[model samples]
Target: EGEWKVMLFTCSYSVGGVHGHLVDYMQPEAVSTLLGMTYGEYDKRYKSYFGDVIRKTFFDDVGFVHMEQTWTPAITEIFREKYGRNPALYYPALFYDIGPETGAARIAFYDIRSELMAEGYVRQVSEWSEARRMRSMGHPPENYSPNSVVAHGDILKYYRHVDIPLLDAILCFRRGLNGFKQVCSAADLGDKPVVGAELCGAYPEEMDSAMLYRTTLEAMARGVNFVVSHGMWYDTDPQTVRIPPLIAPENPLLGPALKGYSTSTGRSCMLLQGGRRIADIAVLWPINAIQAESYMFRDAESGLPIANWHPNDVVNYALSGMLTNDLHRDFTYIHPENLTDGKVSVEGDRLRLNNAENLQEYSVLVIPGGGYISAGALARIGEFYDNGGKVIALASLPS
Candidate 1:
């Protein structure tokens, strides 16, 4: 029998508190409660509402076991319990909306509805996916790309746990080459060993094989491995569907164009996967700074980060987007928490990642500006500098 890989496309758990959103919230007072707090206060405690709540209820020492009755014993196994099922390759096709006012509204809705479980789901899903991937002979689980142009920093943050970073680069139409470059570069630097995650959104309406070939090569150059076309629809009547020609047979490009795309990108994936990267530059993610900026804007139209948004403030967002472009050498994110937690340490004038199997070393740490920072992280940076590690602060010191 042939193997089948299933793709589950859904809103990322990070968008709202995990127990599902309380979209039909009853209380107007709840919105007032959410708006009452300053962004800083919200930033520190947003997880308390969502992530922490789920961690206590769903996960335990043995890992994520499906204990909730609502999820189990259901006809479809909606909670994704893998028991009694054949081992099959599975990957998440994730998406979410953007903008500042939009993000603020999501947080407001969660606060009003008392559904604080959304923020922490991404990490939880990452853990669950890792466990499932281990159970699968060798199939890997790709990560969900963060929503919006500014929120892209979250994609880099995802690298800490996942091997693949899947981005829906075409959805925005605003996201073009610059966007894809930033995304692929981040994934290449992350834990992704050899093969990067699938890059979706190559539509025939957008471009044919020639454009596809060039795009695939560009991604490969930036370190993307596997490729999945934007999508294929079910065999319903062509008139019924809005977007067609997506490998739907009737689409004129399906015959040779699809075949050529599959052939070219598939071969490139084999050549790129399983390779190690070497880098001397460490990009320090301005975690607090990004959070600080995200609070300043509220985008109700799209939804808040469910937890928080990106470094929307001009300085940090622009800096982060272009930070890796001309670095000339490979670079990886230096999580501030990791620095404080000792996951990153100084060794003989070089900063080293302590947790990886092979160990990654970096000589320079570039900190993007504009966020509230922890004293512990500041001390760690001081330690790095004292140990002869180089530092590049974009505009202002973290404070």
Candidate 2:
């Protein structure tokens, strides 16, 4: 079974003066209105709401719950508690250039939002699942792109509590394939045994068995050990089917090969599961740089204020292609949060991620040209370099 938390696009709630939609660009007025309210009131209310829903679902014998599109707006109270400052003071900086402090304010704003979503919602659900001996998994929207700054703050932190770090691969085989590394890297850092991909939804109706197999192989090659084919439709009548290329037996073109394909994938997973990936390069996720550079501007076409485009947005995507296809070097993304939290450290001329299951040691660190970096991460990078580890800065250096 599946459940959506906080924001579901169509329906959502305001928690602590934070509107579920447009989280990244909330105005001062919206946040100021909640100042008179008691601290933690909205947080408690949200916890109650989540607890009630999960309790009822679990009572009905559902062993697993996939929390879909999990994200939260920046709660004013949470911002104050976590950052020790009133978020209303920095509202302008979050959306526009106010002064020299704009960049720093933007980074702090997004950072707290990321922490809130991970701790308040994701961690709560994960703990509940652990207690109940069930499992929790899901991926936020735009998990692959720079839009993740607006969608969920930071991808790695967003999956801090997920039992299986999952990524959504939709449309054609090639689209969004670059995102597999992000999810797989999260699983690797967290020492998660399984990495999942929701495969091949919204592909063309003519998509054949070969396309399915190819997509599956691509995902596997990127460290995905579990595959959840998009769906089996209750009714596959061509006239009524909502999303095409159904995986059920009703699809005459692909049904006959499903059993063999399933067996092949199973065999592949059997060999790959519980294995550690060896990558000599550690690519910094550059989330702080992305956050500092991102801001809302009015869209010329729609007249709506939207997150503006920036070159830093595609750095990871471009790097993924170059490293995987062109350079043919295996790499893993290291979140800056890990550095700040001391989960990553320098050891004997190598940067090491201290995961319980998959302890990764990197001889080189690649910073993908984002302008800003957290002080904690920069310190670690300095240590790595000073200790004789190779540090490669692409395009530009962090200020």
Model 1's TM-score against the true structure: 0.57
Model 2 Cα lDDT, one tens digit per residue, 233-288:
77777767788878877888789999999999988887888957899899999777
Instruction: Report lDDT (Cα) of residue 211, candidate 2.
Output: 90
* Runs of candidate 1 exceeding 4 Å displacement: 1-163, 172-190, 194-206, 240-245, 248-250, 300-317, 320-329, 355-358
Candidate-wise lDDT, in order: 0.44, 0.69
lDDT score for candidate 2 against the true structure: 0.69
Best-performing candidate as measured by lDDT:
2
Pairs in steric clash, model 2: none
Model 2 worst lDDT window (10 residues)? 56-65
